[model samples]
Target: MKSLSIQEINTILNGELVGDTSQMIDGLEQLKNAQPNQMTFIGSIKYERLWDSSKASAAIVNENIRIEPGEGRAFIKVKNADLAMAKLLEEFDPGPPQFDIDIHPTAVIHETAKIGKGVKVGANSYVGKNVVLADGVVLYPNVSIFDDTTVGPQTVIWSGTVIRERTEIGAQCIFHTNVSIGADGFGYRPSDDGRGLVKIPQIGNVIIGNLVEIGSNSCVDRGKFSSTIIGDGCKIDNLVQIGHNSVMGRFCIMAGHSGLAGSVTLGDGVMIGGSASIKDHTVIESGAVVGAGSGVMNDVAAGKTVLGYPACDSREMLKQWVALRRLAKN
Candidate 1:
């Protein structure tokens, strides 16, 4: 583990220091689990009570907090303790190991494909006709990029990920293992004879904006007509499904196993919890939150938090639950 002086940590966090400045902090830990040589933080007032018993030698705290005089513990006071802690953890992180091979010998690149400077294609990867990989893009083993696809600079597509035709991924994006982008949307119509389902062709592509991170095994389907869009800084958790023609606004978060059906529109900063499902053609306005295991069947206003099946306002759901319990007792 890397160690830093208390003074150095204060400088890194741009925080005001109180108490001892010469202590060595070797690692970061939670208040409940901190060792004497480790650093910890109190991000909320709820955790302030933990400070007295915490064994950490140094702590990061908000500037507004008042500390008793003559305490032996060291502190770095910042504007936001949570953000400061995030920066500290980032500073301590040792990033992924670099590979020696820029373009592995086993990788196949079509002659028409444009590979930019500093791009790395790992073993058994395939880049197809007219594909464009911008500078600093990295494709790990067994990855496939189909015809006419474009990936922006500094993006990393991990092993077993596939980017289908006409898909466009933006800069600094990370697609984790087994991700599938621009797959055909699930669309069907009855046959002329009314005997079986006929597949409706998915002719549109997917557009992903910059700084997006898609988790492992997630799938984003292509649109039936217009493009399916994922806006800037959206974070999609593992096993999530984004259906055809859907548009997600900037900084939206979709937790694990959450799904959006075809033509759904999610406004900026919408949060979808685990196992939440939005019906087709639904609109969720900006800053709305769908609770875990929710089934959202209609439009949700901006800044609202909805919960339960056929989700309603959270307070209403709680009241309903209370009424149901009372009736059950009778």
Candidate 2:
């Protein structure tokens, strides 16, 4: 652990310093967990009362918050304490493991595949025919890239992940373990004789944009005729399912276990909480928020917050819950 003076931390965070500027901080922790050599933060007003009792040598707080006078601890006041904490965490992060070899000899690469400079393929990985791995791409152990797939520069795909045929992943993307991209969508048509379901051939692929990070065990399905598009800077959490032909706008966030059915359109900055499900053909407008466990069957307007099953407006949902509670009490 590297120790930094309170003055150095203030300079890094562009914050105003109070108390001892020479106090040393070696790590960052939550307010309740911070030690004397560690820094903590109060990101909201709700936690302000805990500052005096906090054992941290230094604390990061919002500029607007006034701390009680004569506290022994040092404080760094920033415009946004939450964002400053994020920057500090990034500064202290020890990055992921770096591969020594450019390409492991145990890896299998098809004769027709084009491997770019500085690309690293880990042991037992398979790159199929006509695949294009751009410069600086890293494929960890047991990764499988099917025919004609293109992985852009500096992308890292971890173990057990599969990129199916014709999928296009953009630059600087991170695919965590066991992620499956471009798998066939859940599309089945009834047989002409009505005896059984016929699987619809998924002819299209998945297009993932730059700076996207897909968490472990998530699946993004291939479209029947067009691409399932994940836009720039989108962050998808673990175990999420994105159905075929769904188009997500830039920077949309989907939490763990959330799902979107076929052809759903999510506008820029839409946030879907854990376990939320959006029905097929629905449109969630920009900046809309779907609360945890919500089942969205209709279009959600821009900047709206919806909650509950068959999700309705958040305020309306609260009112309904209150009315139901009153009736039950009676």
Candidate 3:
């Protein structure tokens, strides 16, 4: 582990130090598990008890939170403790050598593939023919990039993820383990025989923008006509399902287990809480927040907050909740 003095940590985090600067912090650990040489962070004041009992050399905390450690442990105060800790961890862990021109010996790169400079292809990964991987892309073990797919620079794909043919992923995107992009959309027609279903050919692709993070086990289906477009800075939580032809605008957040039906259009900064479902062809405007477990059946205007099985106005939902509580008491 790389070692840095308390002063250096403070400088790196831009936090104000409350103790000796010369003290060295070799590594980081959880607040409850940190030892004398490790640093920990107090992300919330609720964890004050843990901070008080922590044997850590130093702690990173918010500027307003004041805690006195019985021992002479140093305190580094910042605007947001959690954010500061994130920056510090990035500095300490500085993941994988930034530039690796070498592909792992076990990786199978097709002869027609075009791999750019500084790309790292891990063990057992497969890059199909005509695939284009730009610079600084990291493919973890078991990742499968199919033919005609193009991954932009600096995209990191975790293990077991599969990008189907012709998918285009933008730069700085992060795909967690088990993500499946460009899978055939759920479009089946009843066959004339009446005993079987006819599968439609998904000739379209998926276009993912920069800074998008798709969580583990999520699936984004390709369209039957045009592409399923996910705009920049979108954050998709685990187990979510994005149907074919869905267009998600910039900075849209979709929580765990949520599902969007095909052709849905989500405007910029739309926030969908856990397990929510948006019906097909629905348009949710910018800054709209869909509450957890809600099923949106209609178009939502910008900046609206909706909640319920069939989502209604947030204020109306609260009123109903209050009434239900009172009725139950009666």
Highest lDDT scorer: 1
Top-down lDDT ranking: 1, 2, 3
> Cα lDDT for residue 172, model 1?
99
Give stretches of model 1 more than 4 Å off: 64-72, 189-196, 328-330
Model 3 stretches with alpha carbons more than 4 Å out: 20-23, 69-71, 97-101, 192-195
Residue lDDT tens for model 2, 1-330 = 788888888889988887774558889999998888899988778888887777888888888777742456788888899999999998788787777787888999999999999899999999999999999999999999999999999999999999999999999999999999999999999999999999999999999999999999999999989899999999999999999999999999999999999999999999999999999999999999999999999999999999999899999999999999999999
Best candidate per TM-score, number? 2
What is the TM-score of each predicted model, taking all chains together?
A: 0.92, 0.94, 0.89
Candidate 3 at 286: error in angstroms? 1.4
Candidate 2 — which residues are off by over 4 angstroms?
A: 21-23, 69-71, 192-195
**Of 2 and 3, which scores higher on TM-score?**
2
Q: What is the C-alpha lDDT profile of model 3 across 1-330, one tens digit per residue?
A: 789888888888887888663457888999889988899988778888787677788999887776764446788888899899888888888565442446888899999999998899988999999999999899988999999999999999999999999999999999999999999999999999899999988889999999999999999999999999999999999999999999999999999999999999999999999999999999999999999999999999999999998999999999999999999999
Clashing pairs in 1: none
Least accurate 10 contiguous residues by lDDT in model 1: 64-73
C-alpha lDDT values of all predictions: 0.94, 0.93, 0.92
